[model samples]
Target: MNFQNRKQLIVQTVDERGSVDVRELAELLQTSEMTVRRDLVQLAASGLLYRTRGGAMKVSLATDQFRFANKTAVNADRKDYICQLAAQDVQEGDILFMDCGSTVFRLCPFIRNKRITVITNSLPVVAELMSSDVTVNLVGGEVDKERQAVHGLMAEEHIARYRANRAFIGVDGISLQHGLSANSEKEASTATAMARQTEKVYLLCDSSKLETDKYLYFAPLSLFDVLITDTEAKPDVVAAYRKAGIRLIN
Candidate 1:
């Protein structure tokens, strides 16, 4: 194949699998490994992919220097602020259930120094806290590649076996009218399971996710003990949530 075809194929592989292996690309294109590396360098320079020691990763996956690729990268600063607010609720020696939501993943950094145990279904969460003071228990189940988490009947059952002091979760949309909804039912089920076994549930969402609705409704607003969002939340909207008896920490 020509150089253009090889380059396109390399990009396609990364887009499909989230990362590309240099050896695999060389074999697939019947080219030298050096040639593949050169192409990866150009792609990385163009911001199409990120070069790793062994391969190239999707651009979004490199946003946080993690394995999971999330669209929340667009509003990264806002999400970090939101998660920092949520992290305040965590105390030492607490058992927590962390979700796969990008917003929830942001919580890892803030609480890494705390002495606590975390039960989660997110692969990114595991990678984030692997070298930290927090102990991680990953739920076993079918992998959801797009979300970079695990969710299924097995995952829900696994979550049921453990109880936590707090559960930090994310949602596609959350509002008083629609409650909590998600674009993926499998993910919704995992969230429900986590909340069910937790003493308190904190919903970590940004302003854009507030006052919106998705198709699959999972839990109601009543399930959450607190809603932590960024400063972008409007005064009246914050008041509405407070009036509904849901606490807000911003």
Candidate 2:
């Protein structure tokens, strides 16, 4: 596997088991202990994990908190479905604002062949689209190692200078009370900036996120033009979103 894919697996393993020994990871990855240690170092630097003497441990954050790689592994099938649905709206020449959320990252492969411009803060998104035909403009700012995205005032300022036809974002929580929220203020700010600069905003998430609330509330239900989710979403919750004038695609 490529380094990024391998790093993702390492993050998943650590997340699942809570902690992982370097030797064990090396065995599981079929690579050298040195390489495993190197991976752990990079992941730790990004705030994804805590490196120990001989292994790594998952960071203890709030309940809704998760590293980007770990987030990618959760609800894999649902996220893939949502991403596929969201990709249907992409036009060849569209300029897009892709958020740093894991769900948004899934949209990368589906839209790779289309000739489009993507402005994003997600590191994985940039890596995923680097070799594809899509034009990628990476926003610069403070890097959130755990989220594998850029954030902070500089990033938001850079995003403001450009506009997009569509914006695909991910949220930690979505509820009638809070509207939309994220685990950190930085992420919320970045998403908000993207939403403001786009003509249409698509919130890509799984059904579980509905009715949930997280650390930072960013936008209201009215900010999103559409929500793409898996079919397992609760009927009442789905209805509520539609009633609020946000399009729902299950």
Query: Which candidate number maximizes lDDT?
Result: 2
Candidate 2 lDDT over residue span 1-250, tens digit each: 5679878999898776555567668868999988998888898899988886567767862233457776786678888999999999999999999989988999988999999999999999999999999999999998988778999999999999999999999997788877898767887888899999999999998876777666677788888888899998878888987887778999
TM-score of each: 0.72, 0.74
**Model 1: number of backbone collisions:** 0
Clashes of each: 0, 2
lDDT of each: 0.84, 0.86
Error of 1 at 12 (Å): 27
Candidate 1 residues 1-250, lDDT tens each? 8878988899987876554568668867999999999999988898889997667777877775423455545367878999888888899999999999888888889999999999999998999999999999999999977678898999999999999999999887787897998867987998889999999999888876677676688888887888889897778889998988888887
Look at candidate 2 and give me any clashing residue pairs: 46-145, 46-146
Q: Which candidate achieves the best TM-score against the true structure? A: 2
Q: After superposition, how far is residue 190 of candidate 2 from its true place, in Å?
A: 0.2
Query: What alpha-carbon RMSD in Å does predicted model 2 have with respect to the real structure?
Result: 11.4
